[model samples]
Target chain A: MKLRRIQAIAVKEALQIVRDPRSLMIALLVPLMQMVIFGYGVNLDIRHIPLCVLDHENGQQSRNLVARFAASNYFSLRRAAGSDREVAQALDEGDCGIALVIPADFSQRLNDGGRATVQALLDGTDSNTANIAAGYAKSVVAAFSAAAQLDAVQRRGGTLQTQTPVGVEARVWFNEALESRNFIVPGIVALVMAIVGAQLTSLTIAREWERGTMELLVSTPVQPMELMIGKLLPYFAVGLADAAICLGLAVFWFEVPFHGTVATLLFTSSLFLTVVLCIGYLVSVSIRSQVGASQVALLATMLPTTLLSGFSFPIEQMPAAVQAATFLVSARYYVEILKAVFLKGAGVVELAVPILCLALYAAVVVVLAARAFRKTLD
Target chain B: MTPSAPIVEAREVSKRFGALVAVDRLSFAVPPGEIFGLVGPDGAGKTTTMRMLAGVMRPDGGQIVADGVDVLAHPEQAKRHISYMPQRFGLYEDLTVDENIRFYADLFDVPRDVRETRAAAMLAASDMLPFRKRLAGQLSGGMKQKLGLTCALVHTPKVVLLDEPTTGVDPLSRREFWQILYGLRAEGVALVISTAYLDEAERCDRLALLHGGRMVHCDTPAGLKARMPGAMLEVVSPEPRRARDALAGQPGVRGVLLIGIGLHVHVDAAGRSAGIAAALAAAGVPVSEIAEVAPSIEDLFVALLDNAETPA
Candidate 1:
């Protein structure tokens, strides 16, 4: 492959890109837009859940218990219901995500130093938020009960150890609060690479065919390898710039912590970019129409990266067969690397497997893409 | 036709598309400094022949050689010496004409000094110097074709294969394109041009008349016209259509073609003019003028195709 031919193609492609500034601007900005949208939109933290309380006792102890639930951040007490009928009506009318009900003897039972039972009713429609809200509610009630038990112990002057015999201390390392944003924002970088890289390069060869320029292009002395490299070099650089922007948004804008070294990040991201760009090139050569090629590129790259790359769903939660299939998706390794680098302070040693897998995938697809273009019209 | 070796030659090359033969056993040789024309109607394998010569299409049989390179075995090697312009638009529309020319010069690895002089000369000859900064997409059809030729010839390849370079161009542009081609010929560049306009074939050093993917006649413009077995006579009549009707199957009449000027009647020999006059009189069609004329390549094309269609 002659460098002159490759340079010629690259120069022409650069002119084409510079001549149409709108598409380049869009390609660069779409990733940042997606990052912002996904960072704020796919938030997993469910806060300020509306709660309705039905207290039949109307006593001090019952009021204190209601105040405990209201003080927590997870629940926002909407309104107090009067009776059993009101409680049922509140739950039916979707007035609250969850409801708390206390019986008429609740103050008496608690004052007599005996056990008191209350009912916590929850909405099951939005199961994810409902589940999280249930956990939050349980923690609140548990804390309140512990305080009540300690008070009784102090009243009897019993040993403090008897109040809490066995308790486990849990510490979360990566995400201190186990925030889902950490999980979400890092994966957005992988998605941006998969989507924009493939979308832009997918139109290269197919556009030439659609515009009736490939015939003359192939008639030259340019080899397929030279042409592929020359056509893809500009887009590959664009993809890396896109990666930089998305990474900046993740770290500087959204404040997702990044712990990996810049070298490893760039190297691995370049590998991933190579894979997606090659995939787009292969599709462009196979499909002659730009519309068809871009659609197939989205299907082949964006869909897999979004759905099967463990971006939204955890790969460990997937079935065994699907987990095995995730191995084939190039973005899966990138997602793993993203999570590791962002959350675990993982460097090269901790990320050898994913890096190797991405490199191998890049190598194979590059070969396929290079071999895909033949000079013959047939 | 030259004493020296052929710079580009095809030996019995054939190309087929499934059940249809696009080019059948076509053979020709183009020496340096000659313009070889592939003259035929649409679907007569003109484009296919040009493509094979360009090394873009692989022949089903036989071989093509360009500048000591086996085109079938190594198209890339052959492409160094061959510049092909497709029948359709073959330029990047988003780029300016100058940029397009520079891009081709880069592709062909032309030196800066050579490219600068050559590109400027070509643009001046084609009257495209002022429009060099214009985007290729914004140019007129004829101008686009001219830019395509400039780009194709920028590399100064040994053999230039142009497929209907003026198919959709205006008549004036077509004449200009031919002038540029004559300039290339003067520079000793071998040109293989394909066109459906038989009148354009008159300018070629030699012509190949293709019909149904086969070369029915291959010779000079005058040589191919000389192959017509009968004489062509122009008849101007008051009722030309009726005269054509009366002379449809007259003896010694080969073909009757209605033209804008008059009816072009082909007779077997000069002596058969009396028979045509008598036939028109019997049908009560008054012939205002009757004159004998030399057959064009178009006339020879029709006559040869008719002969090929019939049995001995």
Candidate 2:
């Protein structure tokens, strides 16, 4: 491959990206837009669910129970119902996501040191939200039960130790608060790089075919290897720039933590960028029309990055077949590395498996992309 | 004359697409400082032939040598001396004219010092020097074809294969394009151009008449026209359509075409021309002039192909 030919191709591609409004928009603006959308908009964590309460007894115990639900950050008091019908109304009208119903004999039963059940009615239409809300409500009621048991023992003058006999203390790591933003922001970085990188490079070769420039271009002294290298050099730089933009926004704009070294982050990012660029180049080589190539590139890169890479959904949640397929999706490895580096403060040594996977993926695709191009039309 | 050797030679080159034979045993050679025309209408394997010579395609069953390099064996090496333009003017509409030329110059490894002067001269010759800064997309169809030519010639290739460069271009641009081609010939560049336009065929140093992927005749324009099977007589009458009708089924009258200013009548031989005139006069058509005329390239192609198709 001649370096001069490579430089020439790269320069011409750079001019085209600048001249085409569509390509320019994709390269320069898509990354930032995707980052903002995924970072600030998509949140997996369910919080601040509207809750309505039904009190059958006017006892202090029931009132105190309602107060506990209101004080917790997980639930906010939207309405206080005097009757069961009111609670049913609030749940049916979608005024509340969940309803807390207390029994009339609740205070008497709890005073007797017996089990008292408080029913939680949830909106099951949004099953994911409903399930998480149920879990939160269980924890809140559990905490409230523990405290009420202590109060009953002291009021009865029994000789009970103030300290609990057994307790489970949960200490969260990596993300101590379990903030979904910290988790989602890093994944968004990988996703944006995959989309913008693949999209921009997807049009590179296909545009030539559509515009009839491929005929003259293939007739030149440029080798297939030289043409592939020349075509990818400009896009490689653009991919890296997109990486910098998305990663910078993740750390500074969204306040996602950066626990890893800059060298490792940049190195791993470049590796992933190489893989995605090759994927786009391969799509361009296979499909001659620009629209067809762009769509196929999206299918090859964006779908895998967003769905199977554990970006929006967890890879482990997929079926066995699809989970195994995620290994072929290069974005899975990059997403793993980004999340580790951002939240866990993991370095290269700690994340060697994913980095190696990404590097191997990049090597294979580079070879494929280089072999895919020929200086012949047929 | 090419004193040393030809810059391009295609020998028994054949290509097939699935079950369709696009080109069969198509053999032609282009010497230096000569313009060789592959003359045929659409689907006569003109583009395929041009492609094989340009090293942009693989000829299924033959040998192609360009500048002494085996095109099929080492296409990339052969490409250094060849410039191929497709039927469509392959200019990047988004890029400026100067940028497009520079791109090709770079790809062909045109030296930094020589590239400037070469590009400038070609642009000036094509009268595109002033529009160098304009985007190629904004140029007229004729100008786009000229830009395609300029880019193709930027590398000073030994053999240039142009595939219908003026197919859709305006008449004015077509004339201007020929001027640039003659200049290339003056510079001793071997040019092989494919065109369906027979008028363009007469200007070439030699011509290949192709029909259905086969070269039926390969000769100079004068030579091909001389092979016309029968005499073509021009009848100048006020009512030419009626004159054509009157001579339709007359003895020895093969075909009659209503052309501008007259009717072109084909007969079995030159001896039948006088009989056709008499037939037209006897039919009471006012015949102003009835005389023999040489066949144009189109008429010759039709008659020659007809002659080859019929059983001798």
Candidate 3:
């Protein structure tokens, strides 16, 4: 493989991207747009759930209980229901996600030292949000029960203790606030690199085939490896630039921390970019049409990266078949690396598995792309 | 002109795409400084044969040697000795004419100093210097073809293969394009050009006529014309179609072809023209004039195709 031949192809490709405004926009502006959209638009943290109250007993105790539910930021009181039937109607109409019904004997039973239960109705249509809302309701009720028990102990002339025996303390590492944005922004970097490196590289060779330049190029003394490397160099630069922009936005703009060294981030990103760009070249060489290549790139990179990479959904929670399939997506490993470097402060030694996976992916894809390209020339 | 060793040779070259034989047992030799034309109609496997010789594609069977190098076994090395321009010559529409030329030069590893001088000469010869800064997409069809030829020849390869370089260009551009080709020939470069136009075949030193992926005839234009089966007599009639019908399958008449405003009937002997005229006249088809004439390349091709279709 001659360096001059590779340089010639690289220079020509760079000129094409620069001269064509559409390609430039795809390489630069699209990533920025995706950063803003994915950073703010898709929030998994559900809030401001509407609540309806059906208070049959209009007593102070019932009102106090209603205020407790209203105080928390997670639930907003939409309206009051006249009866149980009205509460059921509200839940059925989808007007409120949570409904609290206080029984008529709630105040009497509590004054007599007898236990009283309030029925909490919840809508389970959107199961993810509904499950979170249910968890919040259970916590509130548990806190109220503990407070009542403490009052009973204090009135009996005994000291009340707030701490329970054998209490478990849960601490979240890296993301103290558990802000989804901190986790999501890093994954977005992997996604952006995949699109810029693979999608753009996929179109390069296919465009040459469409324009009839491949025949002319093949007729020269240039080898297949030279052509593949030359075509990948420019797009790899674009992918790196896109990764940098996303990382910058995630760190400064979105306030996500970058705990690892810059070298580690660059190294991992380079390996991932190589893998994706080789996949793009393979698709272009096999399909040999611009339209077909673009479609294949979109399907092969974007959808799988977003859905199957455990970016938004945890791989552990996915079905076994899906968990096994995630191994096939290069972004899955890259996402792990990005999250590790940006949030966990992990170095190469601590993150060897993902690094090895990415390197292996890069090596295999490059070999396959070279072989496919040689076949195409023949 | 003195004969020289063959710069390009193909032995029993064949290509198959599944069930279809694109090129069947094709063989040809092109000497240095000669223009060899591959003449055929659409789907006649002209492109396939040219591709195999240029080393862009390998033949399914046979040997292709270019400049003493076996192209099939060592295509990359063989590529240095030849240049190929496909029907669509892969010009970068986004790049300027000068940029396009420089790119090919760089790919071919032409020295910087040599590229500068050679590119200047090519642009000057093709009258493209004024439009060097223009984008390739903005150039006229003819100018694009000229630029393609210039880029292909910038490295000064020993052989050049052009596939239908003048298919869609206007008549004037076509003439100018051929003039540049002649200039290359004068520089001792071997050219293998495929064209559908028989008139272009007349310009080559020797031409091969392909039909249905098989070579039917290969000879110089004059030699192929000399191989016409029988004497041709031009018949001018007020109703030429009626006269062709009257002469069809007539005794001593080998074939009847309708040329514009007349019919050229091939008779087995020159003495049989009077019998043909008498036969047409007896069939109530009046002939204004009749005379023996020499056969054109078109006439010979038509006759060859007729013979191929209905074999004796």
Q: Pick the candidate with the highest lDDT.
A: 1
Q: Report, for every candidate in turn, its global Cα lDDT versus the true structure.
A: 0.88, 0.87, 0.87
- Cα lDDT of model 3 by residue, B59-142, tens digit: 899999998899989888888979889898578989999899989998899998898898898788778889999999999998
lDDT of 1 by residue, B1-312 (tens): 444578899999999999999999988888888999988878989988888888888899999998888999988888988999999999999999999998888888899899999989888887889998999999999999999999998888889899988888999988899999888888788899998777888899999888889988889888878788879998888687888888887888889888777788888889777788888889999888788988877778888888887854
lDDT of 1 at B95: 96
Tens digit per residue, CA lDDT, model 3, A1-378: 789999998998889888988777778888888888888886877777999999999898888778888998789999899987888899999999999988999988877779989988899999888999999988877777677667767887879676688976889999888888888888888887787677878888888878888888888888889888988988888888888888888899998988999999988988998999899899998888899998898788999999999898899999999999999999999999989998989999999999999899899999999988762355
User: Which regions in candidate 2 have their CA more than 4 angstroms from the true location?
Assistant: A79-96, A113-115, A122-131, A153-160, A317-319, B1-4, B168-176, B282-284
lDDT by residue (tens digit), candidate 2, B1-312: 345478899899999999989999988888888999998778889998998898888889999998889999888788888888888778789899989888988989899878889878877777888999999999988888888888888888889899988988888889889998998898888899988888888899999989889999999899988777779888888899889888878998777777788788888788776788788888998888888888988778777777666756
lDDT of 2 by residue, A133-180 (tens): 999999999889979878887888965676778887999999888889
Task: Output the TM-score of candidate 2.
Answer: 0.93
* lDDT of model 3, residue A125: 98
How high is each candidate's TM-score?
A: 0.95, 0.93, 0.93
Q: Score the docking of each candidate (DockQ).
A: 0.83, 0.78, 0.64
